[model samples]
Target chain A: MSWYEQYRSRYARLKQAGKPFFPYAVFKDMVVVSLILAALCWLAYFAGAGLEDLADPTDSTYNPRPEWYFLFLFQALKFFPGRLEPVAAVVVPGVSVLLLLLVPLLDRGPLRHPLDRPFWTGLGLASLAAFGHLTWSGYHSPLINPTVEKDPLISRGIRLYREMRCAYCHKINKKGGNIGPELDRSAGSGSEEWLAKHLRDPQSVTPNSAMPKLNLLDDEIQALVAYMKSLGEPFTAEAPKLFTQNCASCHRIGETGGEAGHDLSLIGSARDKAFIKRYIGDPSKTNPDSSMPGFKGQLTEVQIEDLSRYLAGLGR
Target chain B: MIAWVHERTGLDRVWKALFERHVPEARGPAAWLYTLGSASLFVFLVQALTGALLAMSYAPTPDHAYDSVRYITGQVALGGFIRGLHHWGASFMVVLAVLHMLRVYFMGAYKYPREITWMTGVCLLLLVMGFSFTGDLLPWDQKAYWATAVGTNIAGQTPVIGGVVSRVLKGGSEMGAATLTRFYAFHVLVLPALLAMVVLVHLFLVVWHGISELPERRLQDGDPQGP
Candidate 1:
């Protein structure tokens, strides 16, 4: 007999042979299913989800990675290239779904055996394999941008600066408020002791300054100073653009931008390039009470060297 | 005690009719195919419970969505666990639905009288995709933001009607506060209700058509054609 005829006769013989949907079969299924669900709950208790840093629109340093299931599409975008992006983004996936929805309508044969209909069954298997391959490849793809670890002292300084809410008045790299002078570009303007005393009692260093007394401990002031002393003035040439992208927000040369930190018009005269370089790399090394954030790993050493050169050349 | 309640409500008859109903004997290897539907329903139930818990604390807005998620993950007791359950449940449901539809298709269950069941199954698959697209955007992270931009851009490629469709799906020309609200509405309200309705119809059809028996398996006890 033909496959379809054999299938029909077999169905006729088996149609009434199976068990009921309830206690006999469903209950048995439920026992195993319940265990599977409970296992899921157990997994939740053990493998907790990940939480990253708070979303910041301004920080271009971050590399965005989607959830695992969507990674294939993320990887697929790389293949599209430029204006043809819509092909990968839409056309391909779109047509595949349309074909999938049309499967039942297109294939109306009575043959139950998959071998009787090789085309659709083959297509399904092929599509599944393709999706699996794409997902696996996506998971293995390298990160586009990698973030370097922060220094311990700088990390501590950052914590203290945020905790103290110093950013409210004093600007750092264009962030925070415009009430004080910019720190990154205006690094060499303040001496170590002067910077310390200023943090302890702002009125002492700069009379009529609107800054408040944070009432921080000696070590806290030192860490804050360490942070500030790290801010380097931007170098000349291409370094100025880097400064604008990374530093101009808080630091200023004259009247060009924010005044949250001291003016850097004459930063070259106040400190040499080596001193500026050290301060820019890790401000805490120079002024223990500084509030500036160090950019050791954030900026490459070469960029820092160029920026320090530009800073040393300033005011001359 | 059980008999007493049944006496008052006549529920025992209904229970007997439902539980004792002679389903086409889905014996041996063929019975395994029935597993996916029930499993899909179970996953949906779990998703509903977890999703409700998530909604209790979730704030649907541009400014607070990310922070609220952080709060849920970090501060709320078992919040991360609930979120994980919902996340995995969605993926599980999609898998189960696909497997169920495949079984039906391979069995020729969608032929002739069961065409509606097969079509509804396709719609359910579409709903799963919709849920995936909408749920990803709720986190409001960089991944959420940019992926959604790409996803909506895909929607905007819908041939002649791409512009209006994408605009409506995003709730505007650009993704912002309205996009989040609209997606939240569709995710929490619209999809669940629609899914529930479709599920009821699918179940009703299944009950009416009876469980499909495998053509390869022979009768265990006696001939179904016997008088």
Candidate 2:
């Protein structure tokens, strides 16, 4: 059969076999579609959506993650830093979709076989695979959620701390200001009664102390005290000089410090004396990626011994 | 009684005009591929239905949007299920539409007279993506908040009209109540309306041109030099 005759006959057969565009096909589709929808409702009944904590803009520790479907886009953004970010977020995805839309106009191939449309088919498959891989990795990415679940009283105190902007002058963990001390490390030494007095007026509790009177309610003061007392550590009067001079800049032993280094508030609880001595003397000996400057040449042997002993005493 | 009513209205024409249309024969596995477009349409309708129900209880202000969603999920009967349907339906719609496009493209159905159909399809895909981006920030949870911030920040980084586009998306320098309201309006009103219009046009084009006969079984209909 010639191509023209084949085409005419195909149309003729199609016209003869064609049914009314109504109940016959619509009914079949409705049945399948309704069944699928029912299955979706059933699945939804079993697996409810997850809801997390409310948004707290003040909480510096909050970890943000995108929805599962958007993980690929989110991961892609990580690759393009600074000014080049728009390239990853917009240009690449935009260009890819534009190219996809252009496929129809560009590929005027008569052949429908998958093997014949190698470029378009291969591009689609490759993009799909990359999307699948990126989404999978995005799902498996390390959690950015808050690490600790604070007790109720401590949590209330944290809210108050944020509202009061105490962090403007005082840090908790390694987060606040350097004006006063980091409340996390500094408060560990204060007794509940002492924090209460300090909350009323810092001048009354410690002379020459520049801390302001927060004038907190009694219950709020109690909550703050509870929060402070919870940050417990055995007072290490011996190595205070060394810690203040070196580690305090980065690592927060209790509350007062910068966040560029590890929070050492619980390091004493986790590390042994020997490990501390070696790690602090030369952090690279253990963690190749450790950003801590080695104190090997800077500190005397006696000073290293004192610092390690002080840290080791901070047991969990 | 039903037969009497149907006979008077001549409602069988509805069925005849819709479901009983002549479908061109595709060889082998290719026949199953034709169903994808219908499947995508089905999922989209489902999304529309569920999204309507969701919007009834969804507050469009930041102060209440997140809480309203929580209440819908926790307090209202069947709310959680309806929300899941809407959520999953959006995902399914995107997947199915892409598959439909893929099927059409690989089958060489986009050639010649079908260019308009192909172009409308690309528009539909863009609309679907627009729906996804706008709908995502409605929940106002931590994930929603920060993801939106990052997403909009990317828009803000664009040169020239970057700030303007970002402000339009967010309704201000910061994302707040106005942003949520704008997104709600777009999701429920604008995008869906645009999609419905596009979808109707697409269907009309499909019916007018008829489903592209298998490219392998090419007709020697004019334009001899045509691929």
Candidate 3:
């Protein structure tokens, strides 16, 4: 007999013996299943949704968060740094899936009831809880934006500077280290014209300046200039000298400094106190060419004042 | 119909002859465990039809992908619902496939000749995952781009061949238009072709080996198998 005939006869015998068969029993279930399937098909047919625009490679500003289902995985990626990222992203999730796939093999007992298999039931529940928790944690990431905003001019500028992460490359007073320059000391003696000129166009005065021309509006420039002018010797004397020494390896002033940055010879001629202060507060805002980092929160207001004074002093 | 079957005397007669000759002596109850394989097949059919419909409107280019998806969601008739069904169906297929594997495993169905069946099943599962990964990048949204980026980066960490694997998958150092094209090809062509082949082999193995009998005691006692 052909396989289909044999199968059909076997099914007939089973039906004759009062046992369920494929079409008789399975087909009933399939009716309900078919209805559900039809509903889904209808939904999809009527939804009228499609995809988005072509992806841009150069756009780093795109905040590509995962779908809600994958939020936990996205969140998990943040904890991993450098080489460990792969382990967190791939290995952990892969192993979890593998374990899930092996669930049948792992629980090979005859007991079908939950009460009969307490350990297995408990393990399942615990796993569910853990997954839920990890997913929640991932969805609400705290580290994505660590710095909180601060208010008032000095505090706000200082807060904004730190929140913006400025001090990484720039120096302030004799304290903040230099990826950029000594702003505290330079501003004290620096000319308003020189500071304004530097603020407008750093490359004009020094061809190899690490500082870029900050394209600030007139008002922002004035505010920053005022803040930098307030950083002279009369303001605060306790600026950390260690920061200057440590940072000077990559920074310079006038004719004698490091090769990593440009000469601040005409900084006083380039910009006013407020302009310099804002530049120090957020270098990227003003100049796209600036290697000099901002000093928003890394230093206190007193320290910023001292650094601004130090930079203002450069032209003298 | 019976007279027609008897008179055809071609492939139908051959099939009828085989069916009559190979009849088994005994038949048992139709167990729920038997439904799993059929359920998985049902899901695959659903995916195929829905995916084909989706393909009619989808644009594979990076620039147009996101906008096209948006248009489908916002402008097309019932487009969002269809996409949702496709999305949920994919999830359901994964769940059902896994459950089916588990059922087979618990029943000790992977012994002897069934090992090849089990191996093919594994490959099928992997193909489903491949489908998921490739389908995900087609949307070309923020979520799709970054998830794929991270996924490709993970692929890049595979030791000696990591960089090559990542480059091949992504088409470059970063996820871009090339990556989208590569994923689209895999999703629509490569995966479906492989799945169809594996499914055929799986069915052939099932027919050749015959349905596995329940344990002797369970068969005689006629009690349902343990959940």
Candidate 4:
């Protein structure tokens, strides 16, 4: 007989002997379970919503927090001290894991039934109860307040921003550092809708960005947008158009800008448009080895004129 | 020569008598539950060996913390796999330990002399947590940095020692250079040593107190009946 025919006959013999078959009832059950799990996973994804702005490493006001699922760990860290911080963050979790490992060794009673294993059952129930309690407590923990006092709403928004650690990547005032764009001036210049859109899906605005979608609630997004909009009063004068064309590479005027150069907080006071234009036209005139490469060829005369005018109007 | 021979002969007689007296005439049917303790011990041994290997390549500094881990994974031979093994082993150990405890508790093994064993086992569980907490921060990446920050802040919320605890953990008001070193020390020196001693005591106790027997049934005549 051919090998395949011989193997098939052997398989049939094994099957006839009453061994378990592939694609059995258990397999069907697994398929049903997997479909249910996939549906639930999709639902969770929809619930989380969209991403936030690229994380600004420099912003002191940005608060960094984990997702809701990790809030229990986040909340527990609040109770730990210096060296002991790990005790809560790592040790407690580790011990819980260890206890779980020892359960089989420790609870060696002959009883397979729950009634026969009262102590084990009690331990399991108590653990479940404690986990639920801790998670609830974490979800309800008091929000951190900013050092400076302001309108309650504004202050609360600022606190949320910092607690979320948005500042870590984004710069705001001259005080904050900068891995992301400067936001101190962004509030004055960027529209509320733009800010909201960026918060909702930063990648939609700037592709190849590192900011994860925050999936923030509508109210949370509104509060954050309002807070960003309140950062500075509106600028009225026509800013040098060249400021938009060239200055953004290194300098951020407010919400949207770059990291390579200094932030133009009071650019109108620091240097006039004429000087800014000249600087942009040929940065070599100012410093021989200035890393701020000249953008002379990058912009036309009219565009440069508008950017200079725009920058000169920023401080006021 | 005669005196030495007599001393040696007497010692041999004592050893023979002790072994003959202690040996059980019949061995009981061994159950699957008996394997849990041995399994947990096996997991612990795996953790210890893998953990020690990981410590050799780890650099405990903020500047080099991330880079060192990268290096360990990339440059050190089989370092990445070993690290993964250690991580999984720790999780496995915890799981096995809990299973062991459950088996004992359900068996009513905690009664009588086994109560001490159960209590010691609980302490060991706490130490295992200590090991995990300290080890998690060694990587010093963004995950470790903020996680540690949130953790320390929680400590600062405690009534009396809150500020003191937070300051110590962060090395000041926030996580920085000192935090990594502190966590590394605890992970490598403090926790592992303490855990080793605890495990020794736990094992000693287990050996000293024989495994608890299965519960017996009472006969109509008020005599104990065997299973």
Interface RMSD over true interface Cα atoms for each candidate? 4.1, 3.6, 7.3, 15.2
DockQ value of candidate 2: 0.38
TM-score, model 4 to reference: 0.47
Instruction: Give the lDDT of residue B94 in candidate 4.
Output: 65
Cα-lDDT of candidate 1:
0.74
lDDT of 3 by residue, A135-247 (tens): 78876665332232212343333333443355676665344557777666465456766666666688887689887666766655554555555455443444336236534
Model 3 TM-score is 0.53
lDDT tens readout by residue for model 2, A140-250? 877654254456787677657766788898866567688998665668677788889989888987899988777789999988887777665434466877888878888
- Candidate 4 deviant stretches above 4 angstroms: A1-120, A129-316, B1-30, B214-227
Q: Which stretches of candidate 2 lie over 4 Å from their true place?
A: A1-28, A31-35, A141-243, A248-316, B1-15, B27-29, B214-227
> By summed lDDT, which 10 consecutive residues of candidate 1 chain A come out lowest?
A52-61
| B1-227 per-residue lDDT for model 2 (tens digits) | 97898899978765654456676655566656677788888888888888888888988887778779989998888899889888778777788888888888776678656778998999999999889889888888766777777778878877677899999999999878888899889999999899999999999888776666655532367432233
Q: Where is model 3 chain A poorest over a 10-residue stretch in terms of lDDT?
A: A143-152
TM-score of each: 0.72, 0.71, 0.53, 0.47
List of chain B TM-scores, one per candidate: 0.89, 0.88, 0.84, 0.80
Q: Mind giving the per-residue lDDT tens digits that candidate 1 earns over B1-227?
A: 99899999999887766666556665577777777888888888898889999999999998789879978988899888998788777777777888887787666677645678777778888888788889988878766776677678777876678899899988998788999999999999999899889888987787665666554322345332222
Q: 3 or 4, which is superior by TM-score?
A: 3
Worst 10 residues of 2 chain A by lDDT: A19-28
